[model samples]
Target: MHSMRLKDKIVVITGASSGIGAITAQMLSKRGAIPILIARSEDKLKETASGIQGRFGMYTCDVRDSARVEETFAEILHAYGRIDILLNNAGYGKFADFTEMPSEEFQDMMDVNYMGIVRCTKAVVPHMLERGSGQIVNVASMAGKIGSSRAVAYTASKHAVLGFTNALRQELRKSGVVISAVNPGPIATDFFKIADPTGTYVKNVAKMMMTPEHVSEQIIKTMEKSKEEMDLPGLAAFGIRLYGLFPRLADKLTYNVMNKK
Candidate 1:
């Protein structure tokens, strides 16, 4: 149960307005970390900061906007002098068949989910490298590893995240900057409102959904040790391993069990 002593550490979190992002920020703040919140909505970022007792800052920066992201990081670094960690959690998903999905939706997914990580990481990596110490955690999803029915573009975006995280970790091999990925199964969040607008998918997976608190705790633990990668709930992680070992059987099971959602 050894964890990183987070007291007074500065953490930059994207998508900090709600769901896992908001919850994790609060938890870190409780542990005495200054959580720098970033989101597209200034009001929501304010709300998140309000719930935090420790010193915190908020910036409304959309991940899709690369220039804005760079400026935002510059401002944070100027104010704080250093950032101890970064949580790239700002992303959304739209569930639709590939043919029925709008072209813009696919592009948006790539921009926010994949390139967003790229833009934010590009902004922060040099600083971390220069300091010779830091961590970057990218919140990917189980869909990234095991593709499901209606989220083709979303799946591709997360897959890119995994690929980028793995490659960058190698590139930074002896640099002391740690990069990690978090792949979690479905969680109870407003994410479904956009990803499964009809509520059909949520209904199908109602019994299996994990709470934001549960996922946030696991994330905190990952941050504590600077773990290389994590897959949550144990069962889901086991399933992913089975998929790697038996693709044909896993594919059939995914179609029957997961695709229903």
Candidate 2:
């Protein structure tokens, strides 16, 4: 078979417990990349690492802890001598109508979702620049492109991610570092289970959601090509494009049909 092998290449993945991060480790492993899974929950990280036994490693640290993130990353770099890919996937969500939400909740979202990416990218970029080659994939959401009610903080963080990817890709264009963002519509994960146990969003929107594996497959393909942007489930990207070009009509249509309100 053709090798998408990341053999000898090291990939540092944050938020690597369950969901996208978990699946990505396996996929990268299958492709030959040495996986470095990072998450705050050692138990879960170990569980994931155990299942993916190979040339994989695990680190338990909260991505929001900038100093720890940088320190642990340094440790990894010194240990491995090089890091070839960085996936910024550590994130948390606190969803509610913006006006009804506590300020701390929004702050927390920004800290974990946006700052986590910032810290990790900063820690890795120097090595990537020095090597003059690397890839950075930011795990954003479809909410990154579209403003959604009851998810103001999440939306803002993701939008910032898209912007960060765009700017960094430009700044690093001549440096041989590839930066991109993956906008996943809705991947089946415990995220929704934790965020809306009552099925607040999914109870109404599950019909359109795709599995985590689906998005993960797209991520693999995107990374293989070093693509700048990836919109998973294909349809979601189409929807985003169509609505962007026809806002007024799209709004009325979504509100009437999709919202069922």
Candidate 3:
């Protein structure tokens, strides 16, 4: 297999402690990239960094803290010299009906899923601009493209993420900076087992889920090539495109045929 070796490249990944971020950190490090794992849990971050085969480090910061984010970015540059990539993967999902969902939960999702990238991107872009090159990959989801009943806030936040990536990519077009989005379908990770452990939320899609390693591979590929947008698992990508073209038809198919419980 051809290695997309990011040798000597410094990549920062938020939410690097687990799920796609964790797997991506390990995969990139194996391929010669220096990954900086960012998450609130210092212990988990330490574990992830220690297990990496290449140079890996951790930053414990809540992405909601703008001042802390700025400080941390400076610390990274001081240590690594330059940051070549950023994977804003820190996020959470709260599945609940629109009217029944708590207001604070909605705000929290917006803060982390939406504002998290905003704060981190704001911190890293300037340095990239000065260096004349960098890449920011926002981890969005299929929820960004379609409406799911129980994930109103999460869906809205992801849609915002996709929109943000498009707009920012345009603004940075001439700056040698590339900003993109990646939407992944269900993946087998501790997240699902935790958030939807009762299997109430995940039981239905377990059969269709991809492994963390598989999703990580896709993420690294997109990052290496500077892909504008990527949809992991070609099948889901095509399905989403078809759904985009025919919303009502897709909804009917999904609701009636699939029973996407």
Residue lDDT tens for model 3, 1-261: 556557878999999988889889998988888899999999998878777987887889999999999999989989888999999999988776689889998898999999999999999998899999999999998888877777788889999999999899998899999988999877788866544656765777767788888988889988888888888777878889889899999987776323343
Top lDDT hit? 1
Q: For each candidate, what is the lDDT?
A: 0.92, 0.84, 0.86
Q: Sorted by TM-score, highest first, which candidate order results?
A: 1, 3, 2
Q: How far is 176's C-alpha from truth in model 2 (Å)?
A: 0.2
Q: Summarize candidate 2's per-residue lDDT along 1-261 as a digit string, tens digits.
A: 535656767999999999989998998888878999999999999888876856987888898888898899989998899999898988977666678889988888988999889999999999999999999999998888766667788889899888988999999999999998899876679888756667767767778778888887787777788898998768777888888899777767666334321
Off by over 4 Å in 3: 256-261
Candidate 2 TM-score, true structure as reference = 0.95
- Model 1 agreement with the true structure over 129-184: per-residue lDDT tens digits: 99999999999999889998888999999999999999999999799999999999
**In lDDT terms, how accurate is model 1?**
0.92
